[model samples]
Target: MRLEGYVIVSGDGMLADAGGSMPDSLKFEADYRFFSTALDAVDVVVHGRKSFEDQPNSPRRRRVIVTGKVASLADDPGNAKATLWNPAGAPFEAACAHAGVTEGIAAIIGGPGVFAMFLGRYDTFWLSQAPRVRVPGGHGVFPGVPERSPEDILRASGLHPTDTRVLDPAADVRVTAWRRS
Candidate 1:
């Protein structure tokens, strides 16, 4: 039940374009590398239906796609590696068990709602920033929440930026890990 989160946002705090997809201009090898590396250390990957569907393929061995349409893991057949989960119907632990993930970090990859679900529960949040990119009318990382910077939202949830690293200098992208204090 160690929930961790990851998001790559633009300078204007946008996680997705107007079309609700990641901006093509923001794609950088270094940012992707950091995300892949973070996923390597997690046992289960968690995301909303939009994010899950957007990524037809992934490196994650086990994933739980949060959706109200399905009651259990057997509902999703497109990806044998993933388990469909309705949080309203089953507990998080049960979803993990259904995914064959008994214990370890559960990485919450985004689409806003999924990130908000783990608001106060994230053990760590790896927030990567693309400084030069700005998605104006784009979706915020936590869409429905009150207007606040991603850093402020994380801080309000009791997570503080404890460490930072440059992921791609050429793209001016850097990642910061916010750990729960």
Candidate 2:
């Protein structure tokens, strides 16, 4: 199965501000369209609660939410097409099967922890960066921040940039596809 990750972070490597909210600076129309289109092709999306994509089709889209609240895998109370998966109690394949996925792309969206969990499994990681944006006292895309770059961690995980797509040249918003080295 193909596993992919998608995230947009500030130059400082932040996913959101310290208040745990996405700042206006990270919102770009081009990026949104790109992300949404990419998501539409995935068979299933795996994420933590905070990483759930708020898209129009989210209600019916297959999803596996990584959470400790469930012992194994359980149907999501909020969404019929979603499942709550606890890796500690159930295997990933089981979660995927429960989420109605046997193969195809499994998109890993993030809230840091979720992104780090699949670091080594990603077949491709699409990283979007807004170099000019800085979210002071914000959440890093990975576990360790300002000290180590997200690119550094991705490199360590055996992924390298394979291509770049300029989403918004004016805002310096660009996305690079990282593939296994």
Candidate 3:
């Protein structure tokens, strides 16, 4: 099975601006385009409880949220497209099996700790490096990966830059994708 992940972050490595602000309208549009492209290559998505909460609603894919509390769509009211489970009790592989996604891509969206838990298991990572924006005390690229240059981590993870394109240079963001070799 191929496990894939994607993230849209600012140049400074912040996924969201301070206070969890949504990406700017332009950035959001670009993100949706990248998301649609990346998502087309996967069948399932695994996220942490925090990431799940951050989203307005569950996406239209076989979604899994790793949480200690049993998740119910009714409980969230807005999460109509996901099934929640406890990763500790039901391993991620088992959950994927139950979702009938035993092969192909499994995209792990971020929330740092979630990525840390499954980083070693993923086969590829698709990341979009938006132009640099300074956000004081905001979240960085990979929260738990120890403070280091993003380039270093990407290289260490066996991912090589496959493509790069400017997205509103005036906004100081560009979208870049890296693939595992």
Candidate 4:
């Protein structure tokens, strides 16, 4: 199965501010549009409880919510199209199956812990960055941040970045898709 990650981080490698919320500085219309379009192409969306996407056709989409609430795989009480999964109790493939996703592209959306969970498994990680934004004393995209950049972690996981493309020059939003060899 093809697994991918989508994330936008600050210059300091943070995804959210100290309040456990994404800062306004990191939110760009261009970035959101890019993310929304990419997500539409994926078969299943895997994310933590707090990392859900709130865009068009979200409730109708197949989703696997990685959570500690379920021992294994369980139907999501909140959404009929979603499943609750605990990696400790079952393998990722099983969870994907429960979400009705067998062998297709799966997007990995996150809230730090989920990103770290699927660190080395990503076939392609589309990392978006706001070069002018820096969230100091904020939540990082990965577990070992402030000590290491997100690019460093992806490289260590055997992923190489392609040429970056500017999404919003005014907002300094740029994206690079890191693919594993």
Candidate 5:
């Protein structure tokens, strides 16, 4: 399966606010549309619990939420659209099967650790940066990794910038897709 990462960060490479949530200052309609479209193109979406919870339940997409529990949404009474998976307890392939995702692109939209989990595995990283916003003391996109810059982090994982497009010039938001060379 082709694994891909989708994230929107600040100029300083912060992915979330200090409160462990997406920064309000980085919210833009264009960016939201871009993300929504990308997710629509993918067959499976993988994200952390917090990111999944923040979004409204709709369209019932096949999704996997990284969690500590061994149970899946199939086992849960609520949220039949998603599956809760613990990578340490269950294999990724198994999780995909449980979600009924047999193949195609799997988009990893995250909160730090989930980003790190698919670092070298990601075929492409749709990295969006908002230059007008700066989230000081916010959560880094790769929390455990020691890399100083997001570019360096991706390069270290063997991915290089393939293309960059300005999604919104007025907001100074741009998206750069990094892929394995």
Candidate 6:
């Protein structure tokens, strides 16, 4: 199965503002467009606990959230779709196997540790690079990994840039895609 990740980050490498605020309206729209595009191609969506918690209720497709315990959305099941799994015992590969995603696309959204766990296994990466934003204490685009040029990391991850376009040339946000060889 092909596993991937999709995220939007500021030029300074901040995923969110220092106060944990979300992207601006325009950025949010662009992000949603990318997310929707990814969802349409993938049979299942897998995300870390933080990503799951940050999402609003939605009942559109099957989603798997990797966490210590199975997540519950009973209070709003009508709007929340997808299942939850704990990746503690089983490795990420096993979890994907359990989801029956033996082929096609399987996406893993952010939360650095999760990315690190599955980076070597994915076949693609869809990254939205926003223009520089100054957030002194904000979270970075990729945390935990050793510091290196984004290009080097992408190369080491077994992925190479395949396409790139400016979502808003004036704003300097470019959405790029990389494919595993």
lDDT of each: 0.83, 0.92, 0.63, 0.91, 0.82, 0.63
User: Which lDDT value does model 1 have at 55?
Assistant: 35
The runs of at least 3 residues in candidate 6 whose Cα sits more than 4 Å from the true structure, single-residue gaps closed, are 18-21, 25-28, 52-58, 70-81, 97-100
Return the lDDT, model 4, position 107. Answer: 94
- What is the per-residue lDDT of model 6 for residues 1-181, given as tens digits with 9 covering 90 to 100? 6788877766656566655555562265556766776677677778765664243423455566666764332112433445456666666556555555556677777665666667677687877776565445666556532255444566787889999977766667788887788
Q: 105-130 in candidate 1: lDDT tens per residue?
A: 99999879889988989999999999
lDDT of 3 by residue, 6-113 (tens): 776655566655565534632555566667666656787887765632333235666766677763221234465465667666777777776666777778886666
* Cα TM-score of candidate 2: 0.97
Residue lDDT tens for model 2, 1-181:
7999999999999998988778889999999999999999999999898776788977767999999999999998888899899999999899999988999999998889989999999999999999999999999999998789999999999999999999999999999999996
Clashing pairs in 5: none
Query: Which tens-of-lDDT digit does each residue in 1-181 have in candidate 5?
Result: 8999998888888888889988788887788888887877788889887785234423557888898866433343466767788888778888888888879989898879999988879899999999778888888889642248888999999999999999999998999999997
lDDT of 1: 0.83
The 10 consecutive residues of candidate 5 with the worst lDDT sum are: 52-61
* Model 3 global lDDT (CA atoms, 0 to 1): 0.63
**What does each candidate score in C-alpha RMSD?**
2.2, 0.8, 3.9, 0.8, 2.2, 4.0
Off by over 4 Å in 3: 17-26, 52-59, 71-81, 144-146, 169-172
Predicted structure with the largest lDDT when compared to the true one: 2
* TM-score of model 3 vs. true structure: 0.76
TM-score of each: 0.91, 0.97, 0.76, 0.97, 0.92, 0.77
Kindly report which residue pairs in candidate 2 clash with one another.
Answer: none
Model 4: per-residue Cα lDDT at residue 32: 93
Cα RMSD, model 1: 2.2
